[model samples]
Target: MLLQVRELKVGYASGADVLRGVDLSVGASSVTGLIGANGAGKSTLLKTICGFLRRRGGAIAFDAADIGKLQPSQLAAHGIAYLMEGHSVFPGLTVEENLILGTWAFRKERARAKQAVERAFELSSVLRAKRKVKAGLLSGGQQRILEMERLTLNDPRLVILDEPSLGLSPKLVHEVFERIAQMKADGAGVLVVDQSARHVCAASDHLYVLRLGEICIEGPAASFSDRIDELVRNFI
Candidate 1:
């Protein structure tokens, strides 16, 4: 496994526990889908794993090392890239500028950075055409593409996403999953939490259904595909 969470638990101050004894894993080069209803603690689990929130109990292991104590920055340094909900782009920076920032760690390696930028542009021709335009001016789908390109630039070992296709059109939603599928194809482990069970199952190899902070069901994505609607009404 590339990323693993065992018997995880989390809660906010003076509030009911948001996650309860959750366990999930994402294998190298595979996509794992986590689906749940609103307030089901899907995002909370991601936050806990990335160290944005403290775990009340259990463990988090990434690439076989215990990383439960690592902060978000340290987690990123360890090859875990998290794309939170909403458009995570700088309104002021141009598309190319944002892409360059993604390669900042390799800034000294001009050749490598330039290659990464080129490859990113190749991933989205729209982005390439609008490379000099402000990211905020791009359409929502295009901005999502830019973020996708930025994350893949570092070749992170694991990519975690929350609500990746929330407000996009069906076509754009498909595009988001296609890019995520591409990330898996490129050898990155992916753990995604999304609103649509059908779409998630389509892109996932393994699936975990969260209900009220606990994993209620889990299996191969194909196992859940047929009952997607039922699952959404019941599990989600």
Candidate 2:
């Protein structure tokens, strides 16, 4: 496994537990999907793994190295890229400028930076057309694509996405999953959290159904799709 999370526990500032004994893993060659209801600690788990939240107990290991206490920047150095919910681009910057920021890890390498930018453009013609426009001017889906393009800059080893297809049109949502396939082809592990269990199951190799921060069911994605709808209702 490229990322291993064991018996994870987390609490809010008020000491109320949000996650309880969660176990999850992601591998280089697979797409791991985590599906659950609203406020089920799905975001919390991803946040903790990315070092945004401190774990109250258990371990988080990446590539066999214990990294439970690393800061977000340090975790990024280990080839982990986190795309949290919402549009996180610099609203004032032009789309091209934002993409250049993504290549900061290799910006000094002129040729490499150019290649990264071009690859980002390849993901969307709209991005290329709006390259000179302020990022804030783009629609919701376009902004989301911009963020996705930025993540591909340094070719992260593991990509963690939270609500990746949120507020997207059917076409744009399909593009989001297509990007996931591209990531797998490029050999990066993807840990994805989606509200739609069926959509996630279709794109994942391994599926984990989280309910109130606990994994209620876990197995190969295919095996769980048939019961996903019922499981979701039960969770509600």
Measured over all alpha carbons after superposition, the RMSD of each candidate to the real structure, in angstroms, is 1.2, 1.3
- Computed on alpha carbons, the lDDT of every model, listed in order, comes to 0.89, 0.90
Local accuracy of candidate 2 as per-residue lDDT tens digits, 77-160? 688889987779999999999999888876788999898898788868989899999999999999999998898789999999
Error of 2 at 113 (Å): 1.7
**lDDT of predicted model 2:** 0.90
lDDT tens digits by residue: candidate 1, 16-59: 78898999999999999999889999999998998889999999
Worst 10 residues of 1 by lDDT: 71-80
TM-score between candidate 2 and the true structure: 0.96
**198, model 2: CA deviation in Å?**
1.2
TM-score of each: 0.96, 0.96
Residue pairs that clash (backbone atoms under 3 angstroms), model 1: none
